[model samples]
Target: MTTKKLTWVSMLLAMCVLGANFKLLGSIALDSFPAFLGAMILGPVYGAFLGIAGHFVSALLAGFPQTLPIHIIIGFLMGICMFIFGLVRKKAMGDGIMVKAVSWLIAYIVSVPLNLLILYPVLHEVVFVLFVPLTIATLANLLISELVYAVLPSKIKNFGQSKVV
Candidate 1:
């Protein structure tokens, strides 16, 4: 990666960690937004790196390494989903709400089983119904990230596209 790309990746990784530190709805955090931004701007590979590193760092900072796998998997799924949403759909990609919705839904759908099967005992509570809050938090995360990306100057928003292509 170029110096500029590395800086942006570092910034986004910090954003994810900070986002994870704050719970907007129940226990759901806005951490995935930065990962989505990475995916939308830098592509799936960088996005996955952001998600993985961000989750790992956050887990360590929070002193909960045991659940690292769960968070890591969620971030990986977010990257893949965002990549597909942005590159697929003919009309509703980029900053379109449909893209965000699709990405969030796909990521969340994949996360549920993973969370239920592995992280359930860790949380020590019923886990199935939390999807509602998770969905809302995810929507909020993507909306905030997309809005920020939308407002950036076109040049900056298109920063990594040339490199990507």
Candidate 2:
């Protein structure tokens, strides 16, 4: 990666680390914003890296909860789906509200079922309870990503576009 991209990756990781601390709207972890932003700006691979690492780091700092695997898996899935949707959004839609909405919507759609499979086996809680929180958190992440995109400068926004995503 170039110096610029490396710098962004570092910055986003810090954002993810800090954001992970402030959860709101029930399960809506703030960490998702940094991860999604990283993906949207730097591309999917970096997003995934931030997600996986951020989730773990947050958990570690927060006392290493028992539900470690679930969080990690969710993070991984979030990155993957975001990358895929981003590609489709960029190619077919060419950056618009619908693209953001659908990309996020699809990320949630793809993650829920897959996550359910993992959640059931690991957490062993009532499906609805876990499902609701996850949904809220994911949705929050999506909205934040869109907001970040809107607020960012064009120069910074377009900085590393050719490198990834």
Candidate 3:
């Protein structure tokens, strides 16, 4: 990575660490914005890195209420989620308000099955209880990413983005 990309990664990681303070449930916090933003601006790989690290930080802060192994699994799942999210957003990129709206809608909708797929067997019915809050967290995270990405300078958005999506 270039110095610029490294710097931005550091900044996002810092933001993710700070975001751990806003806990929603157990280790689940509103800390995913940085990861989502990383996905948008950096790429899917960075998104996975931030997502796993971000969740780990939140889990750490919460004393690993769900146990370290489970949290580790969750962190990996978060990584997968970020990867898919980045891929979808990459394909969805374009001009037009309708396209933008559709992209946002798809980003939000994409999380449902991913959350349920792995979580259902582990969480069973308990996944239902978290669906709302996790969905809300995902919405908040994507909104923050969209808002930030919208305001960023073109140079910054395009920086270190070559061969990345």
Which candidate number has the best lDDT?
3
Best by TM-score: 3
What are the per-residue Cα lDDT tens digits for candidate 1 across 85-158?
Answer: 44432234355666656765665555455444555675546566666666676677667877887788888767
Selected candidate, larger lDDT, 1 vs 2: 2
Q: Clash number for every model?
A: 0, 1, 0
Q: Model 2 over residues 1-165: C-alpha lDDT tens digits? A: 777788899998999888878764333366767877877787777777877777666666666554666667766766676577556555553677677667777778865666676667766765556577767777777788788888999887776456543
What is the TM-score ranking, best to worst? Answer: 3, 2, 1
Deviation from native of the Cα of residue 30 in model 2, angstroms: 1.1
TM-score of each: 0.71, 0.82, 0.85
Please rank every candidate by lDDT, starting with the best.
3, 2, 1
Q: Output the worst ten-in-a-row residue range by lDDT, candidate 1.
A: 85-94
Better of 2 and 3 by lDDT: 3
Write model 3 residue lDDT over 33-144, tens digit each, in one string. Answer: 9988887778788988999999999999999886788788778888877877666666665635665576556556655556566767877887787788778777877788
- Candidate 1's C-alpha runs over 4 A off are 24-27, 82-108, 111-125
User: Please, what is the whole-model Cα lDDT of each candidate in the order they appear?
Assistant: 0.64, 0.70, 0.78
Better of 1 and 3 by TM-score: 3
